[model samples]
Target: MGAGLPAPLGPGGEAVSTYLGMPNVRPQPAHAPAHPLRWGEPFPEAAHETLANGQMRRNLAHATRTIRDKRLRVTAELPDWEALRDAGAAIKHQVMSELPALLVELERNVTARGGHVHWARDAEEANRIVTDLVRAKGADEVVKVKSMATQEIGLNEHLEAEGITATETDLAELIVQLAGDMPSHVLVPAIHRNREEIREIFAGRMADAPAGLTGEPRELAMAARAHLRAKFLTAKVAISGANLAVAETGTVAVFESEGNGRMCLTLPETLVTVMGIEKLVPTFRDVEVFAQLLPRSSTGERMNPYTTLWTGVTPGDGPQEFHLVLLDNGRTKALADEVGRQALHCIRCSACMNVCPVYEHTGGHAYGSVYPGPIGAILTPQLLGTGTKGSLPHHDATASLPFASSLCGACYEACPVKIDIPTALVHLRGRMVEAEQRRPLPTGWATAMRSAAAVMTSGSRFAVAARAAGLGRVAARGERIGRLPGPLAGWTSVRDVPAPPRQSFRQWWSQHESEER
Candidate 1:
């Protein structure tokens, strides 16, 4: 069969052939489906709300700074850090180029090892596959490894609606779940919550939490440990997301700090992992490159405390049943974009979030996705087909994400795989502008830009506008424009605007030329 052919199914409903391929082609969208990738409001409105919360800003600032500083210290230890980054980027690019073949090989190897591989074109299919798998096992509740793929699909919510409970095993994830809050960071979901808040959540929510549980880290950890231990022991099924999967050996890896992943992976009788198609590496040896880069870029540790690798299922030990759900979930759509496709190279290390000044002030909730910060700003839009025809509306929440950034390149610098996020942001911005222009009625932003263009295109018009701008000094307070009367008020709402200079550069140049003459 050709690479574009869908895999044939067997008697057990699992893919019977290795033809489960996703060719580098963009599918035509009929309409945008509602998914967990975006929600609530547009970036600017949501950010305004989040920025008003002083406690969240303080929590994010302290947590991000600590992680950022540690990452710097540990990454500086290796002289080959840049070389390793280059190698990582090269490997990912190669994977994207040869993805169809790699995926077929991966499915073939995984199936050969007694593991079942199921393909999902979007979030709904993936959730149905998992829910059916859990129902087959007669499992009412399942323990979970922290997985962004699962979060992106809103797996927990789906499970709950089906009368099945999915318990998060990661410490941070458990806190967010118990508190009924959305995750604010990629690695640290509870980054928006401080120690005292966590302690209060545990005290009120955790049934087994010790009395008078102090806000100390150790005490909080032990409380979470005790709570999750029971779930780990009793749960018959577990769901996880893969950090990296190897096509050569059909091996999947999950790198985490605490031992929760180990328990969740091992103790359960049936394991279901929902993984993005872009998470694959070509060979087992290629895992070494990411293993070196991920830890240093994420937690600032030289190595993860627990780096778990499992190949299919092993009898008489570990889970006897394993199912790997390969999810596209708009990945193929993203892949079709030559520039935006690099967003798939993200390793989920979250280095970009730590260094983003916009994210630093507003935090991940403002981005309104499970994948937040700089990565989310670019990744969410592409996944949602923001710039594509028949996708979400131009003024929708996802459309506003690209403009959330200040064009700072800190995210690109911090990325382990070296994704040029700034370039992608600019590219998406242009797409959004085009989308806006196609609207039946012109928007205020579009009108402003057209007006500016009309003035800027002529020397006389520009000179006239410059003199008019100088009149703003009448409303100035000590060389700073604190407030503006009309449409310009929004610009000065959050920041001070300097009064326009008395002399335009053109005027200054004219006077200088006269003096020289």
Candidate 2:
């Protein structure tokens, strides 16, 4: 053990004598409470509407391309990038397998360090806890760090309904909040809006914006800074989400590009951090792996400009009161899934989203979840229990998420922890299909698939179907078929299909054999 590291202790308060390997596994909770993973329309329907927004599409394309190029450049500078990824993945895997023991150890250490630990089974529980904590401090408003966990639980809206104001300190988050819009990207929430549009938002919604605020990045940033500086100084409480939590030390860390996160961590009298259960690493040293992988993968930088870490409250320095809420809204349920569990390895880097062709065009809004893009496609469904038993009903919006990707394998390559996203996608798709099979009334998709299966099972039937497909050439203009009829029309609405060849492969093969003879 390191000199300053605390000795590992078991539940009985004595120093643990064993090697402290993976602990006895506990059964996953039978039910996962309702979460805010999905909303509004299904992915296909939402994508259709978003695809028509030419300006949004252009904005997303440019922003994603720029970020992707930067990530490639920075990652190329590391000669041991793949090794780092492997280390990060291994650390996370160990954390998940030994989660039960780690959680107890984390709670013990955090309590010893003068911080309170709260366990929340769902989003509602988490919101109630945070809201009550703020009210106890007699605070009506709180400054916030950019936190995905809070967003996943709809904490801001919940606070508003409870008569509390939550001011987002992250520039992009503030923009989204002022515009009353959902975040479109993980790293850059306002990515779907360009500078001119942002200037318009700031001028219209920001109360203290200068009379002639320009769209230049510097001007916009200064305007936001002036507005938030007052809030940072005055707020009594702050809320944050942890990028990584060390079970060994009971320490929580938040990484950010801007300095706002540091303000949130230091200036406030009370700090509340909401973190997902899966964000734990067994030891403090394990953080070294992600400290390297995350910055380059997320912001395309050598390191984050601000990385705030706190073990607990510090008297006469920073927040005097600290609370850590460990939330398991749907994590245990997701962890139970053997094949789909890999989705939990995500570090919220958003590197996969930057490289995704689908997200580049349709944007994150199409996914209809707090998490968006390729990772969202697989993560949201499992978290929402889309096709799982004893949970929420199989929602069309959540089930449709798995099919949102093109399975281009770009996400897997871009993932810092090496999550096999494509495999998880295919596995979730199969789960969705199985759920569909149980329905008494068949959907159009299921019916079509069954019919095709029957026809393809027999040689004669397949041959006849092939010949019938040739008739489709009549509807084709040259080599492309436009606007297919009836149920298939949806396929051609966004993409053109190639016209069938003049002759089937079987017929061509037969002709060639006869000629050779």
Candidate 3:
């Protein structure tokens, strides 16, 4: 362990120096409740306003469709894609089921190879561990590769509180950091902004930037490179998140399109990685499936531009010290639910969000959680639990996210691990509806639903109600009904209601039966 680093514990414990600089956002995040009960509140009203950003919608639509099409084509070429997906799922499940054991094995090998391992049960603990490790080495600055785990845990924010500056090496991440904006996309954090916006960010924020830095890819790369080069060369510590950690050799794998990760992962004197427990694979043989699945699934490439792996440390090459922080952070609870467990099978690919209509419209921020889109609907609830006031509880708020899909099953078919996203949405909806009934609703709405339930449950009652409904529809003529009163406002807010039939189905059925007799 790093000098003076505190022992790892679940939550609300004294944080050790090795786990330094992590801020506790809360003892319990809103979406992560302590119990299994469902909460009924819908998504916040802000969702509607954000969904109206036509420019962001256009950019997202263009990028996602282009990537989605390429992914489908590449994925189809594999004769045994289903089998490969099944293998990935099975492997993840097995490792998570025996997480403690695999993690122990990983620890043993890492220690033997001159690396240190730390266990963190949640986001706070993970950040603290990384920050403390960096601070202990007396390094006031650190470089970072693109790491979703680090973002989810808010590691940069933690480092900032301790007066340690962390420079992002990834171009997209750098742009997001420079602009002081939250990441809105998994693959492209700055997807909401156009090239001109990026140029503006660079021009305004970067010192010693070229006067002629255009929005061109190469030019932008050069601008970012020039800014990051000095930081990378001078920094003594680097932080990262691993795509896959091989338990057999304690090797961590990082895949990137740019060479920035290579610079961060290799150049620093001390390297600290905070990775999810679910990121482990049993052996190198498993790489064949994931290496093929990941690039195509994520970037729609046959192979990523740079795939870096390091086990412990090399005597004369790379960092002299390596520390791996294995994070759990509600993963165990997620694993406990059989139906919801498949969410752990995700490889952080943005494919689902790309094709997600709701995500395209609202962008990732409105999901109001780290995880977003179809994946967020299923994942946020599971990770945070449904009983709390967090993002998962707000899943139905967008109300549009579940209905956003044509239920075309493209997300499931597109998933590298083959998660059934539509199925997960239906399951979550049932939970939401049941929660709505369990709690107190407005008197008028509750009474109407109760009365309707009674009428629908009995044949005789339904017959009478249907006839009354038919009379009301007839009075309105053949034109579609555009409005509704009382409890129906939630449904009618975005869509017009169709008029009821002039004749009830029961009446037609009875007449047909009499004719047959």
Q: Clashing residue pairs in candidate 3, if any?
A: 5-18, 6-16, 19-128, 19-129, 30-389, 30-390, 31-390, 32-384, 42-397, 43-397
Scored by CA lDDT, what does every candidate get? Answer: 0.82, 0.81, 0.71
Stretches of candidate 2 off by over 4 Å are 1-39, 387-395, 470-484, 492-502, 506-517
**Model 2: per-residue lDDT, tens digit, 1-517?**
0000011111231321111111212311112211122454677668767887776676777667766887899999999999999998898888878989999999998999999999999999999999999999999999999888999999999999999999998877887788777788887887766666666678888989999986555566677778988999999999999898889999999987667788889999999999999999999998888989998898677876678889987779899999999999999999999888888888999999989999988888888888999999888988876743322123477888888888999999999999999999999888888887788877666778899999999999999999999999999999999889987896898799999999889999989999999
> Which is the leading candidate under lDDT?
1
> Cα RMSD (Å) per model?
10.9, 11.6, 10.2
Error of 2 at 410 (Å): 1.3
- Each prediction's TM-score against the native? 0.88, 0.88, 0.84
Q: What is the descending lDDT order?
A: 1, 2, 3
The residue-by-residue lDDT of candidate 3 on 278-301, one tens digit each, is 888888888788888887787766
Candidate 1 C-alpha lDDT tens digits along 98-132? 99999999999999988999999999999999999
Better of 2 and 3 by TM-score: 2
Scored by Cα lDDT, where does model 3 land?
A: 0.71
Q: Which regions of candidate 1 are displaced past 4 Å?
A: 1-38, 387-395, 477-480, 500-517
Question: Which pairs in model 2 have colliding backbones?
Answer: none
